[model samples]
Target: MDDIKRKYVIPGDVITTGPYRAEENVNLVGDKIIATTVGISEIYDSGVRVIPLTGMYVPRIDDFIIGIVKSHTSLSWELDMRSCYPGILPAQDVFGRDFNPKVDELTSRLKKGDLVAARIANFDRSRDPLITIGDRDLGKIEEGELVKISPSKVPRLIGKRGSMIQTIENATKALITIGQNGYIVVSCEEPEGLLKALDAIRMIDEQAHVPNLTEKIQEMLGSNSE
Candidate 1:
């Protein structure tokens, strides 16, 4: 079904007038679905929502994120996850349960300016979010070009059932690590392929609300989706 429709909207703009359920960044006022933020408004079957063009990422438990090591103390490393609060990776999580602040320096493993792939372990309004890199897939990012896009556009970039990402990967041979927080790391063995992949990602960031985006990206990559 061609149930998806999108358009730019501003605060208080009437996104639609119907029985559509108001979702994120939108409010239902009587029969109208009103935009509660400046962004692209989406109308799908039975639902209406606004994908904000500007906003901070809100960390959620188990959300995979890309973070830049900002600083470290004796026992913990602070990372910038492009969110309101810094992500804290405790020494124990990285250095094992027997970690000692005196003998195990945080910088020994992760220094400032280093990038990492991690998951949000826990968070609450009262404190900074805690992150963990204990999982094999979660750890220091050794290489790749880091790219940032609005967090709201992440879903569109991923597309339905990982189709968009798979399309890009298959065509360009680029390994893309997508962060739920919108920080992406893309790498490829061939320089031309890398460039193409990066361009496709930028295209998505700029035009996520536009329809037929997967087709557009496929054209940009000069290949068909597998």
Candidate 2:
């Protein structure tokens, strides 16, 4: 069987399953075999495997991410979410109001450079990611210094049922708003407090996989204060 399989092996890859000495120009299809043109060869009975040589980012639905507000218009604001395209947050989607309001009021409501907590509402082939701030918790983020991180790391920062956020708040005595797109806004009573909060947030993002991290952070902050 191995010899027969080798006959169909392609030139780029050596036959892993067969040394059949069969005819050339044969192509192996739907078999538990793999061939590599590379010099290395090892015989194994397992199935064919191909490793990916490149990295790719594929966006999906319901991916909580952080984004930066890049521009604003009468109807919506544009956000740079580190994706292939920028996202849009329409005024109606934000306020849940059907009618358009005066330009001044809308501008005052959401200005550029203001970090917003939002979710991916939709996406079309021609348009960018549509974000919505319709939920109660989703909307204008207030009183927090925005810190950016990878969108993939947002789940770690939030933890299970917001445990990580609560831990940071308890430790540094600061308010924190973590946006779905990766925007983190932190506010504290003092500059020192803000710094400590930022450090704690970074630590949480790094150490969130560990169990009992909240307690560990609390202890660390307590020791530093004393």
Best by TM-score: 1
Candidate 2 error regions (>4 Å): 1-60, 63-66, 94-106, 124-126, 205-219
RMSD of 1: 2.8
Residue 23 Cα positional deviation in candidate 2, in Å, after optimal superposition: 38
Task: Please list the C-alpha lDDT of all candidates, in the order they appear.
Answer: 0.90, 0.63
lDDT of 1 by residue, 98-180 (tens): 99888887888898999999999999999999999888798999999999998988988899999999999999999999999
Quote the lDDT for 4 in model 2. 21
The C-alpha TM-scores of every prediction are: 0.88, 0.61
> How many clashes show up per model?
0, 17
Clashing pairs in 1: none
